[model samples]
Target: MAKDFHPPYPWQTGLWQQLRHDRQQLGHALLLYGRAGIGKYAFARYLSQALLCKQPHSGHPCGECASCHWFNEESHPDFRLLSPEQAAESDDESAPSKKTKKKTQISVSQIRDLNEFLSLSSHRNDGARIVLIQPAEALNAASANALLKMLEEPAPDVIFILVANQLQRLLPTIISRCQKVSMPAPSESQALAWLSEQGVQNAQQQLAYASGSPIQVVNEQAQLTTLADIWQQLALGSKLQPHLAASMLIAHSAETGIIALQKWLCDLLTMRLTKQVHYHIGQSGALQGLSDKVNLSQLMQLQKKVDELRKLALHPLNHELQLEALLVEYTRVFVNK
Candidate 1:
């Protein structure tokens, strides 16, 4: 019995049918590539269910079989999933505990674990093994090399599915070994429609901030949305209290504050240079006044600083100090009145 799995909306039903046919012929390795939050993970899960289905149906899982139930319960012996830890501490929290925990990255140790797990015989006495590596590019050099070795001499009856948001970040050897499944971002109209259906009122505005990723439109994180609103307010050159607004924005969504700040500032700087003063304060506004007030050279310099800040945010070291510096720089730019 296959698990009762229904595909997510952004996925193509035709592709699902084609995959079912390919599986019959034993496709050993599949690379599912696409923009993040566009249903790649859901599709990967669907394929896992289909492969483990005890009672298959209509090129999908039957959802009622013993194997399917175990899969849904996440107790399937032959199924493996690998993902990065979501919570990495701020520098303030990290310094005192520095020796206790290492910074998070998919390292060789994890690959070794995978190798050991896959070495054993299947519990179902079937030759199938399903392993998913998400954000596959997270694999550091040694880890990726270890994976390459596995790919070179893949186990009999084993299937590896690599899901990557940024395919270009993956190593060439890794890219060369697997069959690629390219997934495009949904069409603009399609994304907009889905966002509206999800009850996003300012869908177009947020869609612009998302740069076409519909998942951002439906992002449940209030801070991500509020971050956009802050940017909208700033770009509009609003008279609101800067510290109060910034504090509220960061308070609600500390998770993505740096990223949101950097990206929004970049876009604002771009507008300043292009002199396309139409701003999105949850609505587009005339830029005539903002265009005159902001200096093009200052905006260019600020853009470079933001780019450097982005690189700094990637490192786990000095996170608090770095965030503080970022806030200071932003204050200098927007609140130096």
Candidate 2:
């Protein structure tokens, strides 16, 4: 086991116990589905490690044995993890470039490569072999069909754990073959406490921005400062300069900047209709003022445009110019009261 390997979060304790208690009755495949950033992947990894642990205590891996060492070093003969190539390289800042298109799907070749691993017997005496596929929605048509064949005829002593953020994206046949587990999200208090322990500032505001997902709040800390700068420009409303704001908006990536704009527009709309804020709780005053000066019909039309632009954010288009045009329209959405 790795030093980072530990028991599940407080919210996941019951699910952990249920699965551990029924370990013998567990099926060959498990589909762990939930919203993004709720620790589903981490839970799957923990379960995989424990299942292959040579000396597990109370269904937890003892971080000392040879098997545990092998697992920690990512050299366990019986374990295999699958993910999109781009996702695997996401941590490297230089991974994304104009010369190379990012691969988003799990190709059929990846699934075919698993056949050899599935055919091999476990290196340990009767120990289980684990194959973990994270964000299982990444499996496209050909790969999903290839994976479905294996699920249809599962190998003995092999456990397949599929982690998905969007359950509907998976093939229905692939879903039907696995036992589905709905991972739990922490409560407001639980999330706040966890964020506090992790030394996060403004836990309440960040939590709201993350849609109550604590993991996202932590993962997105780096961007929060940039978000704040963007919000300041957006607060100018009708006075905002499109060309200047467009540069700041796409500072990270066009996708990230568009998402920020989308959230701000959503909050502004919500404030206009209900006098309530969703994503930008801290900026409710600004949203309320902007909403008062904005035309409802124009705002709605602009929102639709933004949504369409967001769908095409990954396309190799002139994103800065598109953002600038959107911002120009954004200023026009407001009228003198």
RMSD of 1: 4.9
TM-score attained by model 2: 0.89
Which window of 10 residues has the lowest lDDT sum in candidate 2?
1-10
Residue-level lDDT of model 1, residues 1-337, one tens digit each, is 1122236454456677677677776567889998786778878888888888878887678889988898999888888887654223333255665533434567676678887777887777874888888779788888899999999998877899999988889998999999998865678788777776666767777776666666755654365456555655555453544565556545643445656666655556555667442224443343344544555565567667657766655445544455555554554454333
Lowest summed-lDDT stretch of 10 residues in model 1? 277-286
Cα error, residue 244 of model 1, in Å, equals 1.3
Off by over 4 Å in 1: 1-6, 86-104, 224-229, 232-240, 275-283, 286-288, 314-337
What's the count of clashing pairs in each model shown?
7, 1
Residue pairs with clashing backbones, model 2: 1-68
Per-residue accuracy of model 2 over 11-103 as CA lDDT, tens digit each: 789999999999999999999998887888888988988998988999998879988899889899999888886443542455446334445
Q: In model 2, what is the error at residue 16, expressed in angstroms?
A: 1.2
> Which residue segments of model 2 deviate by more than 4 Å?
1-7, 86-99
Instruction: Please give the CA lDDT of all the candidate structures.
Output: 0.67, 0.88
